[model samples]
Target chain A: MLKNLLMALFVVMQGAAFAEIAVIVHPSQGAAISQDDISRVFMGRSGDIAGETFIPVNLADSHPAKAHFDQAVLGRSSSQIKAYWSRLVFTGKGTPPKEVGSDSEVLTLVAKNPNIIGYVPLSMVDDSVRVVATF
Target chain B: MQCTKFVWVPALFVASTVSAVDFQYGGFLTVGAGTIIDKKESAYDYEGFNCPCFISDFNTAGLYERGDIGWKQDTRLGLQGTVRFQPGLSLTAQGVARGSDSSVNLEWLYLSYDLTNEITLQVGRKRIPLYYYSDFQDVGLAYIWARPTQALYGWEASNYNGASVRYATFSGHWEIQASAFAGNETVRKSGFARIYDEVNQDIRWRNILGADLEVTRDWFTARVVYLQSDNSITDKPDSADFSRPADKQRVFGLALNADFNDWLILSEFNTNTRKSRDEELSIPAPAMSVGVGRRIGAWTPFINYARFWEKSKDADYENERFIDLSATLRYDITSSSAFKFQINRFSDRSEFQFVGATTLLSANYNLVF
Candidate 1:
């Protein structure tokens, strides 16, 4: 039968080349994060983690889990995070992190914002968010 | 003039169509070209430009003369816009459009705010933060150099009218940032005094004050800066004879960077001075730049070196040096575009041989959208 549809399309392309990714938040948010506070809140340089005021979100630069969350949590590449946010968005100094489009739209904007934060693909996490780190 | 500085870009799009702001908008472009594939013939003559020229932008005196190529010495086109209005205030504006003076100026028009989540508070007319890529030097897809190093990035007043504050945090894994500023400027027809008087000159700096600091870890970074000012000039056919008054100036800077995920490094150093309220003239002026690169995927190639010298101990002041060397490659071409190719040389060890020794051969394409 066409070799079982080419072994079911090579196991769904090897499970999307070894999926993984996670990092969500908002199951009534409980602060605790590190990997350098999610790489300084996805490189807009901190917007809190233990001082509360979170709100990072992104995954739409042609999402492939945004190139595996920009090479596993912003170690860069996606053209160096688009040249580091084009030098902080042409120098008004910073503003980058607010993009959505998939993984159920970042699990419905991190299950309806409790100070949002996002990332997905650990088999599209469920239970209304709260994974808080994985790469 | 320049449509009254863009009449606030159609009044910020009619105040973001009557309230509930947001706006956004972006842009950037380069499309460059160059020429002067080598030269040496010197006999001094800057005010009439020609004879191996190559100023490639000294605060927009962007020359390159020496026949052919030359798409306005590094084309341009910016745009930017912000708006926001809530969640911590905002309102930016930018406008560019150059091809060397086919006009359309009004760079940045600040207003940021966000006084917490680690400080920030800007005011108006920015750029003059003086190096470390002077706050996104026209965003050539955020640099890999197709330009930068016009011997220490020349300036005579690249905007200022400011009030700044910025602060960013993350201690213990480093990544700090700081700034403080106060400004004034006047520039009127001073493309750095038309490379030395042709006519319309006029420059000032006045009360300006400054500060800077930067830090980073994980592939190192460092920076420092300081400044002070009160300079002056005005000629407009007043036929120079020598007398520049309000001089007090001071500056100091430093930078160091590294990347290491495919090797890269960049450096800078500066010194300025200027005294002379007739204390038998002081002058000073030192500069430096360094670069290196190596990323081979979407290409990257780089190399650079720069200098500027000019120390004077008054023996009748005459120094003014120069040096530059470049070699770029870049490529990316997506993720917001890029495509470079350079090859510069410049030398001109100065003793009034102003824009002499040259070499150049550029190309660019940069973009942002």
Candidate 2:
């Protein structure tokens, strides 16, 4: 029984292995994105990146992938983010990243806007939205 | 007042007209009704006492409908706007009714500038930032509770008109913010006081000052805050009462929040006091409380317990302790709106004291732009 439980735990741990949030852009767009720049983009703390401007888009709050990105990337929850932006919003300091719907939808939108950067499941990666940086 | 109302129109219309400006303005009006059985004590006719703090005075001024049997839901319509002008500069403004009772009052207004790569500054009228929820005390989007602990931020000087600066990731996964402010030091005035001021004098107040700090990491966020306020008086229209001195009050607070995958943990505490040195005149009362909140799927159910104990030094303190148990439920109606409802039961114990235990139920829809 102990060995079986250990095996089950191992499976669960494997399922929860580290993952990355792929900051994606239109495949045709010519923008070099570094990993650190991607984190700054989604967090909305970035002022300027490269010569071209950056527009960060977020998955809808209710989307499951959003939770994954928050845990695997931003390392927080929707409530924490809301509390965070509340401090910013109430004081006129920071604006949260704009939210879009679905992984595929984010891919489509980012694929169309040169300035746009969004995150999606690795499975959805295609020429439509170029993976700028993974994680 | 008309000018005050107009300033919002052009601003609202400007964003509304913008074809696509990450701006979406929304809010809701709710009607809540419920009955509560006092688990503690009963009411008293203290309104007729010699001290004479009128029923309307300690009544519900700038407060919700007792959140009990009446329209306890502080139904309100609010507007919030976000404008992005440059990479490091943005502006946001929010305003809401103090309650179903107060006339329109400005809630928040500020302009922010991100200086350097890690520091940001804001100037204008804003929440005092004295608690985790101070910045969004009345805004309903940040949590699962109908309201954060009143003990955590119930002081009269919890809001302010001034400036604040924030340093985020100055070193690592931590951020710190501080603010200083001054605003009208208005007190809990009775009807008689209002009458005296309207008929005999001007309604002016002294400047108040305060500040707060917050830091966060991968899985945790913490905060501490303090505020001091000068006292004001409602002098008699006809009397030899040379009585109008500054009343000094200080409030200190702390809160911690942690999240792990599907589980969450949160706790907050506060202590507030009012008095003058020499014991000239003093509320001399200090109060504090703690609470916990969690989330589950699309529906996040939460429970919180709080206690309010007023010192006996001042007659008003009453040596009374207030205990409250509350539950809240939330469901997302759309990507941009949510429906929330809450139920709270209150208990108060102190011989001959006012403010007793009551039960209240309320609900509202929250939307944003």
Q: State the lDDT at B146 in candidate 1.
A: 91
DockQ of 2: 0.19
Q: Write the per-residue lDDT of candidate 1 for residues A39-88, one digit (tens) a residue.
A: 78788777678987776777777778887788778877788788788788
TM-score of chain B of each: 0.33, 0.73
For model 1, which pairs clash?
Answer: B57-B62
In candidate 2 chain A, where is summed lDDT lowest over 10 consecutive residues?
Answer: A82-91
Q: How does each model score on TM-score?
A: 0.36, 0.71
Cα lDDT tens digits, model 1, B1-369, are 011122232332253346545667777889899898755555655778775788888887888877667897788988888887765788888888888887788888989898886798999988878778887888887779898886777878877888899888877788889888998988778787788777867788978899999898989998988888888887557544224568888889898989896889898999888887966589888999988999887889989888998888788778889888888999996777889999888888877657888888898898887
Query: What is candidate 2's lDDT per residue for B1-369, written digit by digit as tens?
Result: 001222232342243335432343333233233334333334442333211111111112323223134343344556666564554566666766544335565666666778866777767766666667666656566565655655444543444566667666534435454545556533333322332233332222346566666676556777777766665454555743324565566777777777663566777777666675555545534444444455555566767777666664665434646666778787655434567777776665544565555566667665543
What Cα-based lDDT does every candidate model obtain? Answer: 0.80, 0.56
